[model samples]
Target chain A: MRTSKKYIVTGLFLILLIILLSCELMLGSVYIPAQNVFSVLTNNEHQNEVWNTIILQSRLPRALGAIIAGASLSVSGLLMQVLFRNPLASPYILGISSGAGLGVALITLGSVGIGFTFVPNGLSLVASAMLGALLVFSIVFFISLKVKDVMTLLIAGVLIGSIANAVVNIIQLHASALAVKTFVLWTLASLDQLEMTDIKLLYIICPLTLIGSFLLSKQLNALLMGEKYARSVGVNILLSRILIILFSGILAASITAFCGPIGFIGIMVPHIVRIIFRTNHHKLLILFSVLIGSCTLLAADLMAHYFITSVSLPINAITALIGIPVILWLLLGKKDISKTI
Target chain B: MHTILEIKNIDVSYKQQKVLENGSLTLKESTLTALLGRNGSGKSTLLNTISGFLKPTKGEILVSGVNIYKSNPATRARLISYLESTPLSPQNISVKELVAFGRYPYLDLFTSLSESDLTIIHSALFQCGLSQFSDRFFNELSDGEKQKVFIARAIAQNTPLIILDEPTSHLDFIARREIINLLKTLCLKENKTIFFSSHEPELCVELADRFVVTANHTFSEVNKTEVLKTLINS
Candidate 1:
């Protein structure tokens, strides 16, 4: 009976994702017709050049970016929650997003003080963000070797994140008006600015890492019982821990490098999936998180773009608006939220 | 009777402080051995060392003539199943699903649970009197029922020797008796060599076939009457 329920929910999410993706493509600022959107997507041609460009250039890449970012962040959150055995653990809990932000801040905000006035290109921005994320993650990994307690590692990550944010704020204080504006806008996070090349890079990284996480479902399930029980059942705890960290780190770093730290979705989507599916089994959780995560961000992005007449809200604002209430409801409900972890 | 377990003169330590020094014991096949010790008497340390969770500073442990420390984790898992005093209470896992974790050592990465595995899981649940509660969530069960579910998981592992640390702690008098009785039945019916540590010697006195007492950092086998006296006097 549970297996059939899983199938039905999975099928429903797939259809929901398709509908959301279509709405994202069709109901944008200019409001292209459904048939015109379909023709533009299929034949790469439309009678109206403006609508064609809107569909192919702006809407298409943004839609794909939302899907990849949503799926990557949600899966990363799920891995962190299981790895740390804490429900509040999200992809950004380890400070990788803060590291990425620090990197972007240094390039965009710090460069002003050093008399470099040029706008940083996309490639350089990605490289610096990735470098910062890896640097922080490597430090956490090193500390994990000596600590032997996951709670300590979690505290260390929080402290490291605070230190990185402090440095970013100091740089922001001295930056020029233009540079500070650029840094602030990046922190707000927008899915609409990703180029096709950026989307392609995300396609390569996120799917491979997500597949790797899926293959580790059995180990994750065993670990839910605790490390000792997992080891007794023949799981190599060290190897599994390293692999989980590496996979979640890469996913978070790649998305943050491109999308400027899209928040709330990473922490919120897994809880929603767990509540709906009513199982902690990662095999089912990972698959459904990917689908539902995609649908959620697509819907959020559609609202961010079309909610007002002509003004697009920041993606982060919309996600937090959606995320906070669900989390509040889960906490206030009859079921204890801590038990879910 | 064939000897199923052998512990040579092993020394165990916690944080560089020796807890047990030069300890040795042996167990026969299809027998239930109760470990009786006072608080902080190194009973848990000894059990952990035997279950391969801790490395002895100087000694060797053999299960059925093979050195356990020399084998891989999967091989050790096939040799023995261990239950800690307080296993984690994970949410949203059913009783049957938790028991199926026993087959993990036998499975490769790509293979799902086979028919034989399912049969073993069902039999384990039935033996533990948890068949009707198989669909219940782990946290929803009472302490006694949860202990049985954990034992059912250990039984489903299908190992020759099983080790448990304080299996009957924090239970009512009736639940304690029931757990001991269940352990005794598993030994007689399944022919498993069972070694468990417990604080309640009175509950185990009627059912335990053998008793080993941990006192003064060493292990000694004592008779039924002497074991109770030793525990009370300690």
Candidate 2:
């Protein structure tokens, strides 16, 4: 009975993801018809050249970016929560994204102050972002080793994020107007700005790391009981910890490098998946998190694009608006949130 | 019965401070050994060292005549199953699912649970008298029930030897008696070696086959008469 229920729920999530993906491709500024979007996607000859260009160039890449970012962040969030054994843990809440943001900020804004005229290319941004994320994650990991209490580590992550944000703000103060503007817009976070080349890079990095996370499911299941128990079951705790950090760091860093620091999706999606599935098994959790995460971001991106006719709101704002309430509800509804994880 | 677990003169320490020095004990198969110690008496440390969680500074532990420290984690896991006091009660995990975690060491990364693995899990549940509670969430169970679930998990691991830290600490009187009886059954019926630390020596004196007391930074096995005299005096 449980097996059949899982299959049905998994199928439903897949269908929802498809519907959202189609809506993301169809509804946009120009409002291309669903059939036209389908034809364009299928490589059929469309009558309107402008519609084809918009569907292929703008909507397709943006939709794909939403899927990648959503799945990557959500999986990373689930990893963090399990690793730390804290329900509030996520890539954004633990300051990993801010670390990536700081990396991007240094490259984009700090170059203006240094007067080096350095070009912020895709490779440079990705490298810096990953370095920053790894740096913060290493600190968090070290702190976790020293302190058994996860709440302290959460606080440390927030403080580290604050420090990174402060550094970004200081660099912005010294940067040129153009550099500051670009950095600010990046902080607002968007999916429409990613080029096809960037999408190709994301496709390589995110899917491989996601697969890596899936492969670690057994270790993760062992970890769900705690470190000592996991070790008793022959899990190499140190190696598992390092691999989890590496995978999550790369996932969060690559997405932030491409689409800015998208928040809430990582932390929010896993909890939703856990509630819907009513199981703590990582294999099922990781699969549904990916599907549900993709659907969520696609819907959020759609709202961000067409919520208001005149002004295009930041994707960050829409996600925050959707995510904060869920977080609040999670906090208020549970007397002790840590028990839920 | 043959000696299944042999601990040579081993020193256990936390950081640089030594806790147990030259601690040694040996246990035969199918016997229940109860470890009695006062608060902060290094019983847990000794248990951990024996279970391969801590590296003893100057000795070797052998399970079935194989030096456990020289073996890999998988070998050690198969040799000994350990249950910590107050295990985490993870939410949304069913009793059967948690017990299935015991089969992790036997499974490769890509392989799912085979028929034999499921059989072991079901038998463990049945042994613990938790067959009806297999579908319930772990966190929702009462404290005594949760402890049984953990024991069931250890049983599912299918190890020859099992060690537990303060197994009856938080349990009520009836629950504690039930647990002690259950551990006794596990030893005699399942033919497994059981070692567990406990504060209540009186409750264990009736069922325990042997007693090892931790005091004065060392461990020593005492016969029942001596332990009874000590208990009566203290």
Candidate 3:
């Protein structure tokens, strides 16, 4: 509905959303016109069978993929922001996604052809990613316990990320061309190949995870006042933090498992939500972030596909292109905001 | 009245650097004590140790006659509250939401906010002049308003003792006076023992019931007469 600024923002977001869905349905290796796209989307079964197959088997799932990855990554981003209490904190900066990647490498690339039969399979790869994310989460968490400092935890997360990157690089060195190619392709990142099964998986998981995130609204609200205040209020600081981190890790790992470490959406969208709404109320911020994140990723996905021919530009590349400007805008804006500390 | 917090022979250090050596302080029920010190003094450390955020090298902190360090953090939090040097960064939180955090100890994990919790939150907001700002985002509030929001949170916490680390550093002249007045009123009206560290000796000498002068790694009590003498002599 056309409406006021808030609804307008929502409408613009939805408009962008409709365009993105259409782009996803219409553009690919084969270009289906807008009409044909709509026809197939509706119940007109007489559309070109091949184009219809591509639309049903490929485009719809891929569009749904973008939506899920976007929502999941953004929620994790919001969690990182609250957890660290730093506006700049995000899933990518904290290296949570990279941790997931390392898990994938270890389980898939790292364990390939090795003698340890217990390294597990596809399920284990997901488990490994979750485990990897949990490992970093725990390390950061434990260090937080010892350090009692937010900045130290941020620095430690960076170090953890760098270490994970180094390990990933080492594994990449020994990987087979096929395995390495798979990893690289996944790393280049795209939502193009998402199957209906993956979409269903995300649809089921993301809503539950997001609800859990929203349920922590009061806890997160308390955290913004500082940890001590939260403790004073009877929030078991460790338990609340652990819950937030675990929730963040699950969302990050789940998205990374399917989307191959999509970037910048997790890093930038939350801030945009905060800036636009100018509120730290977690209930509003959480929902706004989810919508903006989904829209932003879908828009980015559409651009990644249509902007070039033959080879799709990585979705990460598209996000960085958009995300960096926002970062610079925030940096410029910081001078005016007076961020003491 | 039973002692709500006991600091006995505390020796806290940052690695090799000793911050507090054999430092000790006792907080009794229904007492407001000012922790006065220079910048590098260990006032913050002492407060943190009492609140179970840090460990003393060779001492014990007893809350309600129980060693606070021996108790788990959650139980200890319910007994004593510590505010840090600066208020935590504001996420998009409202005054009402911030105050509700004080009810956390009473509420189960993931439990819905209860009627009693709402009563506490409302009273806290009303007590701190934050009722009008209940739905306003924390960041949108001025520094003075934010400080009040935190005080409201502590009030809602309903703890017997509240420890604050420099609650008025960023406020202007009028705001500082208002906050100090508010805190003193809380002590008298609620019988909540307030312990806070401040560099402002004149403010302490004027406002506090009893002031603890922490300097040169030692502490001493300054009674009302001694407080004036200390203020003039220093």
Candidate 4:
């Protein structure tokens, strides 16, 4: 029987999430009082100009950016885990991020000869990243159809990653030092420099994609077993797989497009939730993954925000510090995850 | 006896290699049938075809006297549940939580668990002797315990017919007999038709109400006594 304690744990997690998210909004470079923050939120006409700009222009967008990035990456990771039925599988595992890096490279290199005049200089780079993520998504999706084995798909993913890295390096070699620096900075994956427009675009896309993922929770849970098991459970394997890939592509592409390719949070949050709740219940996992992801990213973002007085660290660096250890612990515990194959 | 399933002249292939040719079988309501076969003998293939996981190249799989291939898969799942030989054990899931997944076919999208669904899950856990271990992590359980948890999930599906591939392979001899007896009790008490493939020919003959033997990629029915004899001779 379910207990009151379970409800308490869930409530506690929610409270922790709220505290972290609020701290994310309040604890930036220019500090604002709690009362002033509330007034800026509610009394729009009466608030101070500096407070209004900080809350509206800087803090709100940054908080939203962190949320969108976190949810997308975590859910993307969850979907890949189900699609390949591997604990280590993630959206970044297929080398899509590296491919997106290549796309960003092409755009940053100032290839005016390429088509699409509608894309302006900065936006073109983002679009190229999206296209790169899409291309990688298609390749991995296609390979999965041919190879039923998860390990084979992983091998293919590694091979694709290697090839994509080679291409990215080739692009780097031809580009100028300044462009290479710009590309390298982007690859570090930061949460800063998010404009209001970028926030709006993410707001529009990420939630819609997340809703689509929510609808496919049962299907994803079924896929945790193999395809035959999924089908026997009444899941349409083809349709579900397509939807998963599509949603995952949007999330991965969005993060890579705006914030660069951040890893670990995507791959780690679902595993964390699985460990906490002791269930792959999609309904629970889907909801909690978003929450845990937001909390994890916000905590990491805080570290990035306050770690150095002189300079802010990239978000991915903080995540790597936290995530790698959990992974190491899982591996060292002898869980026999690889034996699933 | 009312017929629940009919497999008519089924020919199945994996890409180009033919796996099952003109395979056919019929199942009556409230019967327990054991599927016996060697490795690569198309036993799992037949189960897949029958469950609508794979469409046979040339044949019809009918469930509840309706061709399952024609019925939309969601509806077919409402009638049949198939457990794979080596299913992925969700690491963090408890026995109770995994069994609750069986209600997926009954509930609509966005519909949370109703009281009936909880009741079914509770009963399944009880039947599979997992009532006491409902909170234990699935990965922490022994292989025999995990097999019972899987059976509990199938039981929670609440379908009239259930299919399993090699359900007893994970258990020791004593645990194997206990699971077999548990399955037999389910068939008798609930009037649910059960079908599972097993390598233990003697166990199948002793336990199952009917025997379905797959030899040389072909399936045929044999009397329990004859199946026992065949096992001895082979």
Fnat per predicted structure, each in turn: 0.63, 0.75, 0.58, 0.65
lDDT of 2 by residue, A1-341 (tens): 28799899888878988888888887767788888887887888746899888887888899999999999999999998998887777867667777877887898889877668676775687678777776776777677677655567678878988988899889888888877777777778888777788899899989999999999999999999888999899998877877887788778878887788887898899988877777898998999888988988888898988777456678889999987787677657665566767
CAPRI-style docking class of model 3 based on DockQ: acceptable
* lDDT digits (tens) for residues B1-234 of candidate 2: 889999999998988999999988999999999998777879899999989988999989999898988998888888899999878888888999999999998998789899999999999999999999999988889989999998998999999999999999889999999998999999999999999999887887888999998888888898887876654443
Query: Would you list the clashing residue pairs of candidate 1?
Result: none
Candidate 2 chain B: minimum summed lDDT over ten consecutive residues — where?
A: B225-234
Output the better candidate (1/2) by lDDT: 1
For residues A76-165, write the lDDT of model 1, one tens digit per residue. Answer: 999999999988899988899889889988898888778877588877888888888888889888887778777888899899988999
Cα miss at A200, model 3 (Å)?
3.5
Predictions' DockQ, in order: 0.76, 0.82, 0.37, 0.54
Candidate 3, which segments miss by more than 4 Å at Cα? A1-23, A26-52, A94-153, A163-184, A204-206, A306-311, A322-341, B1-30, B37-41, B56-67, B88-97, B112-119, B130-145, B170-174, B215-222, B228-234
Quote the positional error of residue A159 for candidate 4 in Å: 3.8
Error of 2 at B217 (Å): 1.6
What digit string (tens of lDDT, one per residue) describes model 1 on residues B60-135? 9999877989998899999899998999898888898899999889987778789999999999999999999988
Number of the top candidate by DockQ? 2
Indicate which candidate wins on lDDT: 1
Q: What is the DockQ score of candidate 1, to 2 decimals?
A: 0.76
TM-score of chain B of each: 0.97, 0.97, 0.92, 0.95
Least accurate 10 contiguous residues by lDDT in model 1 chain B = B198-207
